[model samples]
Target: MTVEALLIWLIVGAVAGWLAGQIVKGHGFGLAGNIVVGIVGAFLAGWLLPGLGLGLSGIVGSIIYAALGAIILLLLIGLIKRA
Candidate 1:
């Protein structure tokens, strides 16, 4: 990817991660972890939502998608922990 694209991705990743962190709450997976979760969350969102004709696009979209996916992931984690 181009330098600009890479930068954009990083910016998106950071924002998405922050949003995800907010939705998930507590746990607080640090900045790096947030980026990782955000990246993975982006893919997860793309996979789950788009199949239903509902994927977010662009930076803000990615952030929203990531937050939602993060919420799902956190809920799953919570359920697994309880069980």
Candidate 2:
């Protein structure tokens, strides 16, 4: 990917992760952690959501999709930790 695209992805991931952290209390990984969660969540969403026929257009939609995926990731982590 181009440097510009990569930068955009990082910014989007950071935003989505931070938002997910706020929505899912006690699951935040702070700055670096959140960035990782968001990037991984983006990859997860890119794989899972498309299979479900969920198509999001533009940057805003991408962030929303990433946030939803990150939220799911956090929920699963919470479950695993409790189990």
Candidate 3:
């Protein structure tokens, strides 16, 4: 992808990660960590949502989609840690 696309992905990932951290609570992984989480979450959502017949569009949709994925990711991590 181009630099612009990469930058957009990073920004979306950061925002999604922050939102997920806030929603999930006690799962904040700082900026870099959040970006990673968000990007992974986006991928997770991209894979899962379409299968579920759910698809989001536009920047806001992207953020929401990624945030949802990030939330799930954090929850799984929490569960794994507890176990």
Candidate 4:
């Protein structure tokens, strides 16, 4: 990826990961975990949202969607652990 793309991804990942942690009511993971979540969540979000006819555009949009996805995954994991 270009430097610009990488920078954008970093920014998006930071915001999205923190937001995901907040949504799931869990302590935010360290920077590395956040990066993993944010990047993976971006793809997950892109896959899932389309089923509902929702979409994200640009870095901000993608980050928002990705964050939501990461939150869902975190929440699900919490539920599974509690069971």
The TM-score leader among the candidates is 3
- Poorly placed runs, candidate 4 (over 4 Å): none
TM-score of each: 0.76, 0.89, 0.93, 0.85
> Which clashing pairs does model 1 show?
none
Best by lDDT: 3
Clashes of each: 0, 0, 0, 0
Tens digits of per-residue lDDT for model 2, 25-79: 7556778888888988888888889999999989999999999889888888989
- All candidates: CA RMSD (Å): 2.0, 1.4, 1.2, 1.5
Q: Which segments of candidate 1 are over 4 A away from where they belong?
A: none
lDDT of 4 by residue, 1-83 (tens): 89998988887887888889866776778888888887777777878888999986887788899898788777778899999
Tens-digit lDDT track for model 3 on 1-83? 99999999999999999999988985577999889999999999998888988888999999999998999898899899999
Ranking of all candidate structures by their TM-score, best first? 3, 2, 4, 1
Candidate 1 all-Cα RMSD? 2.0
Task: Report lDDT per candidate.
Answer: 0.72, 0.88, 0.92, 0.82
Steric clash pairs (candidate 3): none
Q: So what's the TM-score on candidate 3?
A: 0.93
